[model samples]
Target chain A: MLAEGRIWKFGDDIDTDLIIPARFLNVSEASALARNCFADLRPDFAASVRSGDILVAGNNFGCGSSREHAPLAIKAAGIAVIIARSFARIFYRNAFNIGLPLIESAEASEGLAEGEKSRVDLSAGTILRISDGARFTAKPVPDFMAGIIRAGGLVPYTIERIKAGS
Target chain B: MPMTITEKILAAHSEKEVLSPGDLVQVKVDMALANDITAPIAIKVFGEIGRESVFHRDKVALVADHFVPNKDIASAEQVRIARDFARRHKITHYYEGGDVGIEHVLLPEKGLVLPGQVVIGADSHTCTYGGLGAFSTGVGSTDLGVIMATGEIWLKAPPTIRVNYEGRLNPFVGGKDLILHLIGMIGVEGALYSALEFGGAVIEAMPMYQRLTMANMAIEAGGKNGIVEPDEITKAFVKERGPEAEAGAVYYRSDPDAVYERVITVNVSDFGPQVAFPHSPANIRDISESGTVLLDQVFIGSCTNGSLEDLRDAASVLKGHRAARDIRLIVIPGSPRIYMEAIREGIIETFMEAGAVIGPPCCGPCLGGHMGILASGERALATTNRNFIGRMGHPESEVYLGNPFVAAASAVLGRIGAPGEL
Candidate 1:
């Protein structure tokens, strides 16, 4: 799948609490969580984020907490893909489990400017900076993760497995 | 290749002879856990999967500790979902009301997790069980749901980082300080996707509670898990819990020739009480180097340090002195068992005499769910795990983390001071 969007840049150690504060965690609805995405760190995120916008962040994105709410909030907030220099282990798994694509590209994370248009070819594992015509390669998603993404996340993938008697 | 304890545990559960870092394997979980914050989501996904019953009713644990006693209608609803699901599934380890405690502490206290077992929880602090030699880590709610249905989850075998702490610990320095110091040394992502196997004289001499404290904060360092090999201490602790606990327990240690991704050694002779500054646990400084930062509140509880020993330490410091006139000291014993033990030992009276409020056994203000939340400009010193931005309340509010001794002493001084200062 190809994703085209404007970039929203963030720095390192962007934690789960900042993505979706604990105050709003009582509610698990996707839209309810989306409304409070980045409620504390970026007060304008929920309202200003456009659909299909890409997020670029520094190291250890989603560092604290194992709340899937953090990833669900970002995905519901119209973030099509997250390109980070790195990601915390659990958040990396949670995002893909929910079918939210993430790319690891230090070059793209550093080279892309905020609000600049970009295109990400998910299967091709390449990122294109539309404005500057700069291209960067992302580490290919692992084989197992690629399969999960193709099946539209873990729930459906798991459902298929259970049905197939595996 | 010879294997570390983590790889050995994974290999045993996955039915593999050997495993390597970055190898994806599907392993059966000995115990699967979810709390109020994550259980509702897991329940929803389980409903979508249309599973009639959980994979193993005895293996699944649902605890309503976070925002428990129902912080609000919303939190009440979340707990209700977990309660209903637990009842529907006849989950053997459903805890609530008088029985509930922080999931990480509650699990070990009940002997639900054992050595050489692969345990997974929806909460990040699930690694706490690794202190008992279990290979435990956190996963998302959906992952828990899948595990509930299939009794298995996919995991990448993490490379192991062996951290050896030699030398005698300084006065008042404990597991909380040591873990904080380690995180400060190796930034948050230092151990990312790796298992931290703690060893050396200090770790061997450390008590079970202290070891659990260190393992509890492993996630703060971006670790997949933090483990200490099972020894006489682990065996004694498990045996005391009951016969059932010792039944399936298998103590596994890393082979002498096991490979490690990195080996880090620290001499603890000079290490003192360490405090993680606001906004990040990695922003650490020795208490001696920490400036006079006043506090609005001091919380001396959580899965990290809310054990019986932690309460004893805090009560010892607060025996005679009362909290500063304007400061709020909230003491939450980790579980009902610990609370009752404190009551039996007169520790509750010490805290009450210190002008502190004793909260029920729940997460309390750690996650900013309820209890003593901070205002915009307020600051707090806590014995809990993370001090991320806005963790305890308002976004502008700040939190500092230290040991229970520091927390109690800071309450008396109304600032971030230590027991020696008191």
Candidate 2:
């Protein structure tokens, strides 16, 4: 799914703690988590976010602790894609596993304005700046991951695979 | 081409006869684990599956850590459910206070964990066992519970990220600090969804126990696992625990031209005991730089910092002074084994005589469920992993996170201080 959205800018290493701090960890539901996404690092995040927004962050968008709640919260909060210079390992996997698109583009973090709208082309592996005609190449997803996305995430894809064999 | 050890294990289990990065495969788990925090939820989901339990009984481990000596009914009930579930499922090797330590520490130490085995723990630190050459990772409770009942889970093999840290460690700068430095450079997610291969002189120079600490924190930076190539140090670690653990042991190295999604080089000598201020482990600062933080308590425990060496470091600074009367210092050994060794060496008595409370071997104040939690507006310094607000107790309580020496010196000053300042 291709979507055009404004940038939600973040600084270096916006960790899981910033996204959904450990204090909120006891609560397991994703809906409750949306209230606290970037609550610590950016207190106004929830109010500032628009539907189908893209988070453009300087290095390490999701780092510190393997809390799945972090990405689940961002997805529930209407974030379309997270374009970062780098992604923390576990969160990257968790994001894609849950069907959240994360693209890596250095310019997205540096060149894009917070309110700037951008088009993320999943199949083309490109993020086009609608406001500035700037284009950035996102690292291509491996063919296997592409299949999981086509199948709509790990749990659904896994269930489908198991059922197909049965 | 000769296969890597990881490739061998994956190929053996792949139904498609080929394994590649991001290829989701449901393979057999060598072991599955859960702790007090994650176990209850896992049990709930495992029961929901309505599936018959087929997992090997001996391959599951459960440890009561986070809220041990239960401070409240929620934690108390969490353990009770896990305790009953462990029994119902015939899941033997459930380790508690005396036999139990941090899941990461207790697993490898008890010889239950072996190399080349695929281990899954509901806790994030499950990746720690990769230090022993296992393809270990963490998952959510629902995922873990399914694996518990079915003995299988899906994995999307990640691209490798190789970090070659070469050089001798500066004195008293432990693996905890080094990993913190790496997190700073990597910004926590540079190695996302990848295996971190740690090699070169710096890793080799670290002892087995230290390597375990490093691996445990790998998950903190969002890695699936952090692995150190098995060496003589690893062999000695297995041998010292009174068992031949080599049967399941395996080692992996990077190909000369092995493609890495990212490669980071770090220098440990320049780094010192780092602390996270406010919250989040990534809020790192050198110990010496945090000269003005006032303290209410200093904690030394958890699978991460409660080793013999860590205890010794704390005791060294604490020998001459008492903790500030208002500041509480708590030290818990990771395992009963480490506790026994520390007692024999008089570390426990030293701490006790210094007005520190010695809790049982368990995770305390790290996840902030119970024991040593700070009060609102009060401050404390800790050696635990996360320093996130309310992570060690009250959401308003402040935690200044540091390593053992920094915590100890801060304990002496009743505020944050560098190691040698005392």
Candidate 3:
């Protein structure tokens, strides 16, 4: 899948509490959570984010909390994809399990600037800056994870498996 | 093939004889847990999975700890959904009301998680069970929902990072300091996607409660799990729980020749009380080096360090002196059992006499869920894990992390000071 969007850059260790605080976790509805996305760290994130915007962050993006609400809120807030230098273990799993694609590219994380339009080719693992025509390569998503994303996340993937009696 | 303890546990559960890091395998889960916050979402996904009931009633645990005693209408509704789901499935390990405690603390205290088991929970700190030699890790709610249906989870075997702590520990320095020092040294992502095998002389002498505290914050360092190999201390602790606790237990240790992705060694004798300053657990400094930062609140609880021993540590410092007039000191025991033990030992009386508020055995303000949230520009020093932005309350509010002694002494001094000051 290819995603073209404006970039929203964030720094290292963009923790779950920063993405969606525990105060907002009482409600699990995607839309309700989306309204509070980055409510504390980036107060304007929820209201100003446009559809298909790509988030570019430094290392350990989505550290702290195993709350899937973090990724769900970001996805519902109209973030199409994320590119980070690296990701916390659970956050990486949560994002893919919810079908939100993430790319790991130190070069792209350093090169991408906020509000700059960019194009990301998820399957190809390439991130291109439209303004400078700079291209960066990302570590490919593992095959098994890609399959889950292809099935639109783990729920549908597991549904298919159970139906097939696996 | 020589395998680390983590590899051995995963291989034992999976249909494989040997495994390596990054090898994806489906392993049977001996225990699956979800709390009020994560369980509602998992229950919703379980419905989408079209499961009639959970794969196994007794193997699944549902606890209402976070935002419980029902923080508000929304939190009450969330817990109700988890309650209904638990009742519908007749989940035997379901806990709520007075019976509920932090899931990580309550589960092991009840002997639900045992050695060499593959445990999964919807909460990140589920790795806490690794202190018992279990191969436990956290998963998202949807992943947990599927695990509830199938009683299995797919995971890539994580590489192992062995941390060796040697030398005699200084007085008042314990597991919280050790773990905080490690996080500070490694940064948050230093051990990303790897199991941290904590070993060496210091760990061997460490008590179970302290070991659990170290394991509980593994996620803070981006670790898949933090584990201490089951030894005589582990066996004795499990044996105290009951014969049932040891029924299916397996004690596995890393082979002498086990391969590790990396090895980190520390000498504890040279260390002092450590603290993680605001907004990040990795922003650490030794107590002497930490500047005089005043506090608005002092919290001593959570799955991380809310055991009976932790309360005793705090009470020892607060036995005679009261909290500083302007400071708020809140203490929540990890579980009802721990709370009752504290009362029997006069620890509760000591806290109350010191003008402290003793909250019920729940998560409390550790997650900013309820009971003593901070206002803007306020600061708190807590014994709980995680000090992320706005973790204890408003975004502008800051949090510092330390052991129970530092928390108590800080309360008395009304600033970030050490027990030595008293």
Best-fitting candidate, scored by DockQ: 1
The worst-scoring run of ten residues by lDDT in candidate 2 chain B lies at B1-10
For residues A1-166, could you state the per-residue lDDT of candidate 3 as single tens digits?
A: 9999999999999999999999999999999999999987888999999999999999999999999999999999999999999999899999998999988999999988999999999999999899989999999988899999999999999999988988
Query: Where's the lowest-lDDT run of ten residues in candidate 1 chain B?
Result: B101-110
* Model 1 spans with C-alpha error above 4 angstroms: none
B1-422 per-residue lDDT for model 3 (tens digits): 99999999999999999999989999999999999999998999899889898999999999999998998999999999999998888999999999988898899899999989999999999999889999999989988999999999999999999999999898789999999999999989988999999999999989999999999999999999999999999999899889999887899999999999999999988879999998889999999999989999999999999998999999999899899998999999999999999999999999999999999989999999999999999999999999998999998899999999999999999999998899
Error (Å) of candidate 2 at residue A34 is 4.9
RMSD (Å) of each candidate, 1 decimal: 0.8, 4.4, 0.9
Off by over 4 Å in 2: A1-12, A30-58, A74-86, A98-143, A146-153, B2-27, B40-50, B71-84, B95-100, B149-169, B184-186, B241-246, B251-293, B375-379, B388-401
Query: Local distance difference test, per candidate?
Result: 0.94, 0.75, 0.94
For candidate 1, give the lDDT: 0.94
Stretches off by above 4 angstroms in model 3 are none
Report i-RMS for every model.
0.6, 3.4, 0.7
Q: Taking chain A of candidate 3, what TM-score results?
A: 0.98
Interface RMSD of 3: 0.7
DockQ value for model 3: 0.89
Fraction of the real A/B interface contacts present in each candidate? 0.93, 0.23, 0.88
Error of 1 at B86 (Å): 0.9
